[model samples]
Target chain A: MNEKLDITLTVNGRSHALGVEPRRNLADALRDDLGLTGTHVGCEHGVCGACTVLMDGRPVRSCLTFACQAEGAAIETVEGLADGDRLHPLQQKFWELHGLQCGFCTPGMLMLAAGALRENPDMDDEEIREVMSSNLCRCTGYQNILRAVRAAADVMRAEGAQG
Target chain B: MKPASFSYHKPGSVSAALALLAQFGEEGKIIAGGQSLVPSMNFRLARPETLIDINHIAEIQGVSDQGDHLEIGAVTRHATFHHPVSPCPLGRMLTKVVANIAHYPIRQRGTFGGSLSHADPASEWCLVAVTMGAEMEIHGPAGARRVPAAQFFRGTFTTAVGRDELLARIRLPKLPEGWGTGFYEFSRRKGDFALAMALAALKVEGGTIRAARLGLGAVGAHPQRLEALEAELTGQPATPQTFAAIGARAQTMVTPSGDIHGSAEYRRELAATVIARALTRAAEDAA
Candidate 1:
């Protein structure tokens, strides 16, 4: 409730103008101000990647980014992944492969994977596990998560080659 | 937890940012990527009255190859070193060290100048800077000055960058031809802070070590160059015996304090092992 700074950010292809405190982080602004809520904050520090989001096509820790710093940048959250009724291929693979049990880390994991796949769709199992290890998960033991990302990568690569 | 209230200033130019730094002095902190500073602020560890965001300063934001050296802008992201958008001769060594720095998301936002200014003892960039003899270009009200990496880091979490100055660029010298480098790290986790690490770059000619540069991290208050080891390796055959002896000598060079991560004794032993392994790798690469 101190002095609030005005910022305009493009989130999920939609522009939002809001007044935010300089101290407010990006994860809080997205969840509280915009009501997106998909980006969860577990550690609130850079160690845990639960608040991961794509910033201008690169995955960044939203909890570590101030809302004021995100002005004029394009951000993509987990809510922006699905295409209306149809789930993203990564989301479908996660559901089919049981990638989540508690589902707390699923949103951040999806955002990280989406960004990673977008950059390189031909990631192998080791690369997938190595890249996904940033987002810590206590629930599903990570085997299913690894399998899900692999499956999604295969599908995404085939889809990319097709179109 | 959230950070306390503070004013944010996004300067459009490097001079404007420096002016803000001079105006605020110790009360101001520069934010390049905010990966480390924001987390510390959220934990209530750092509460600067004003945050000078230098991310918008376009002048200090990319890599420039200067023929003999690579000039990396202050705001150059860690991910850029891994998959360099521009030409970089230090690509091999950078790829190995970048992966060992935190994780993918952190690399996406963390910057070279931020890491250098933060000056964590276990930071891979600090070790790399010392091993490569890089220079830090700093700008302030007094104008610009370049400090060699050896004199840049003062102590744990401290550097030569004045409170009213900003790190503008890092100048990393080109490795000489016939040189090979190795970065060996032993962190508890893949992307966690290293418990102990070794950086080695060697030039072997006619099966003899011509020149060697060695650095150790997480075994002391700051990453330090092992000048004695470097001198001892000169003129000797690049062999396992020499590396073993170098490892033993390196164990006596550091003074590490016992902490939650590990004991001083454990770190010394770990440092020796990593040094030996790094030397072997560097020799193989040179061959």
Candidate 2:
């Protein structure tokens, strides 16, 4: 049943050509094949949102998306969130605001938020909570996740205003 | 869970996709957005030998003004409706109703046409299409044919779309001037499917309801329009009492089957409550 296709995945500003089966979802392709383990797989069937990632600048459930379907699309995961040793505003705020206690859902939450805030940079705290509710967080009760995303949005907005 | 192995075919255009569908027929399943189909595939509920991925088909994407109606391409994702796609009241309805269609990520990839084709009883888009009297334009080897929403949706997880045909685009009638829309749903969780949902569009003039459209979803096998109630609304005074009266009647109109979410009687109550809420919102805009 495994008919492998040689596909090029453009992820995190890098391209990786790998021969993967048609059954390989984007989450498994990233974690097992490409060694980008930041994406967590939970509920594997699109719920839980632990495998959320950006496909062409929009957040989508990587667990529900086949790897071959993602060819030529730009993918963003938690691995691409930071700039070198300097943490991204979102990552920094998550740290300062205590966004994670379990850390398993962190990568998915960060990527989901990063994609959401990019789409609507001026989202207020209430709007942030609405969008951030896409991913489930069992720890910290989601108040801190909402706080982190809101704070990061402010920083991003200020930086955006300067330029 | 992983999906079963299948031969993948990415068609660059609608014609190519149709050709693939015609060739594979029942064996080839069209994959657009893959929000619902892939998950069912993951559970092994659907195991197609050939998967025709329509993501690459650029011709069937985006929403466009088709003069009398808005033509939404089959591959138009739910996220596309987050903003008003038109200046008409229909645009407002789309934006208001889209947020309830699962979470942000699922909406980003879930296509409107795919939702209609999937025909999930709880789908927001399905309710919208049925309420709006939308027309579906399907493409097949024979030619293109149009199916109205009333006839398009057959049952739960079923539709009029043929095995060799593709729903290329959806045509939603541009609502008349002075119409206001309302949508309300009761879901247990933020992104879960609704237990009961209602949508209404009302046009009020001179304190009288001129035209109205009403629909209920998730409480039954398929989304249903309260056509008799819609007729009853015309010439009636635009008042909350009148809306509540119709809402009360609507509760008995739909035969909502029971599920794990709620009992049949519970859904009947929910249906009535949601109808009242939706009608109230529509009237707020009409006011």
Candidate 3:
């Protein structure tokens, strides 16, 4: 018998009150309990970074973070990135620049870049490459991922400046 | 894979956390960032019955400058240092070193005090702490005790912290105005554990090396200061030849074991090269 924690996670501007066991990871809670399967889990260990998500505006591995640990945290998954049907700037750039082949690592890459660019909107190509190196992508060879993130960063900056 | 079932306690204060840690003894663990611990737990390597999560303890969550030193709280996130924490040159050095620790997201969650407590030989924080002469403040059932970083690390993944004790804070001495610090590391990938790394702090005055501190990591079981090289550097000119000469002696000082990543002889060679590079950078950057 394990203890179940009654916790509330604010995901994608929606509040989800979940009673989860202490051992249940945040990725599982988001996918199974909340029915948000966009957050993929490639490696339960924190290596692949496939389950990356934004907790309080900082990117973190959902697989390593326990659901209980994320209590009261503002969780932002891939499902939260789009404004209705229209794609976010990062997603648009990834699609136009051919950032993915298998799409297994696309969600994590997008979230990681979103979090990083939000904090630093004026990153150069080298800096974008360095940040993109955090996640693994077997199919697209990473060049396209870096190009997509850098291009999206420019677009996001332009949109913010216009606003 | 998930962590084995355990009772999780989120303590608001250091004393409360220490109390729970004391009560659980060997069956307990303090989960900081869980960047390293959670991975091991998922692999079924660590099965603690009780988890003391100190993330909510605001008391142990930031760094404070104490004129000559910095008192970094135990749970202070590594992201806090992304921007310089102190005006001292040590802050710049720490920023440079922190960049090499894993990747972006891991740094956002990891902590300086957690890295010191983990005491991985390849850990850049451990190398910096041991090099800078950091003092660790630990709380336990008996009270609190301060342990120097030199004596704090026992071996790979082992430290001076006892079963009932918890690392509360780390006090690192700030480098003076004229000193320059340098760090160099080699790893297989962008965010892997360093195979060989060197950290050097140098103070040059009037074309002569007045002070020097050198530390090497991941070449052996524990990170340690190169006192012999430090002594050799002092009183010598700040030149590439001098640094290279001292670097060659690093292979003789350390007895590293061979692993799949590198042979013992290869690590010894890497140690010398990185040490030389770090020293050269330090000399070039020193004001």
- The lDDT ranking, best first, is 2, 3, 1
lDDT of 2 at B233: 92
> Candidates ranked by TM-score, best first?
3, 2, 1
Which residue pairs does candidate 2 place in steric collision? Answer: none
State the lDDT of candidate 3 residue by residue for B32-127, as single tens digits.
Answer: 998888899998999888888988888888999999999999889888888889878888888888889999999888888788888888999899
Q: Write the per-residue lDDT of candidate 2 for residues B165-219, one digit (tens) a residue.
A: 9999999998877898999999998889999999999999988989999999998
Span of ten consecutive residues with least summed lDDT in model 2 chain B:
B251-260
Per-candidate clash tally: 0, 0, 0
> Candidate 2 falls in which docking quality class?
high
Candidate 1 per-residue lDDT over residues A100-121, each given as its tens digit: 9999999999999999888778
Q: Give the alpha-carbon lDDT of every model.
A: 0.90, 0.91, 0.90
- Model 3, stretches more than 4 Å misplaced? none
Candidate 2 local Cα displacement, residue B196, angstroms:
0.9
How does candidate 2 score on lDDT? 0.91
Isolated chain A: TM-score per model?
Answer: 0.97, 0.97, 0.97
Tell me, by DockQ, which candidate is best: 2
TM-score of candidate 3 chain A against the true chain A: 0.97
> In angstroms, how far off is B147's CA in candidate 2?
0.9
Runs in model 2 deviating more than 4 A are: none
